[model samples]
Target: MFSYLVETGHTVEGAVKSLERKLADMKLQLLWKYDVTTKLFEQGIRLDQDYWILEVSHPDLTKKMLVQNQWSGFFLPCKMVVFSDRETGKTQVGILRPTSAFSHLEDPVLRDLASRLEEQLISVLNEIEQQQVV
Candidate 1:
């Protein structure tokens, strides 16, 4: 399982809908979507394959954390690892796969495929900007 934190580019309602369509097109099942503003987490219609969580959050909030501090994608909690900073003052997040499995996947094909799919999805969202009614 490869964990990726994709920047949705925009955090508006329209962006969320666009992302939903893009994910469907990519064949990645929409597991759930969390709305930070409303504190609501809705379960999406199940698809046939792998599950994905799409979260819509303000880029500005992340930007502030990144620019003001020396943080990268480490702050967010990933599906593979549950991390809490306050209690231990240490990061618990680690690679999604076991060390051996992760190390074994050294081929460029997987990377190329992911890049192509991401670019295609972003392009689709850039063209349509409206509230998604799923």
Candidate 2:
């Protein structure tokens, strides 16, 4: 239940959109997103800001992960979340690092794959964090 969270002045929607756009440049795909805010609204609960889960993936990398270990499918598509605080209106984005799960195994190959993916994912987040709010 942790996120490598970053606070930003950008709107939550804008932040996520920016990251989605950036992913292409990093050779990653913006697979899907779950709009938590919208879902909550449907449930009759209103939030001051926004929330979402952005699923990201890379074809070659993902295939390689599977080749390395089929069990690694669970962490194939990395999950990144963006949110804005109700009172502050400040946006934030963070990811559940996949390396955490991969590192648990004693296999050097799996750990290496995790390290590579972790680096790339963190790079995306770091770049997005530097983007100026619109």
Candidate 3:
């Protein structure tokens, strides 16, 4: 699949905080956060649900990938989204699977690296899914 997603018992904010902690524990940096709902609102578009995009990266791994293939830098700093599911009244967190994202390159080594990264990212999402709602 192109993405790994999970429904969380927590609110969107709670899920985002949990993700921040999990990412830090795994030595991944949360580089940027885009509040999609707010942005849309500012543009006079009403998005009733909360949605956020988080950009995260492991410096060492990013450097290694870039060093090996400058083209890979295009995919640097993986993206994950935390959003509210209006239908279910639950929050969800998901990532664009690294392996799937890098598959376009068709490089075996990059694919292997992406697989490893995907595992770590999936672990983070799973941990968040397992957290108690707070």
- Point to the candidate with the largest lDDT: 3
- Sorted by TM-score (best first), the order is 3, 2, 1
Q: What lDDT score belongs to each candidate, Candidate 1 first? A: 0.36, 0.81, 0.92
A best-first ranking of the candidates according to their lDDT comes to 3, 2, 1
Clashing pairs in 2: none
Any residue pairs clashing in model 1, and if so which? Answer: none
What does candidate 3's lDDT look like per residue over 1-134, in tens digits? 89999999988888888898999999999999999999999999999999999999988888878877889988988999999988987899999999998898888888988888999999999999988874
TM-score against native, each model: 0.33, 0.88, 0.96
Per-residue lDDT over 1-134 for candidate 2, one digit per residue giving the tens place of the 0 to 100 score: 33467776778888887888888899989999999989989999986668999889878878888898888887768889899876777788888877776765566887787778778888888888888765
**Cα deviation of 42, candidate 3, in Å:** 1.6
TM-score, prediction 3: 0.96
Error of 2 at 117 (Å): 1.3
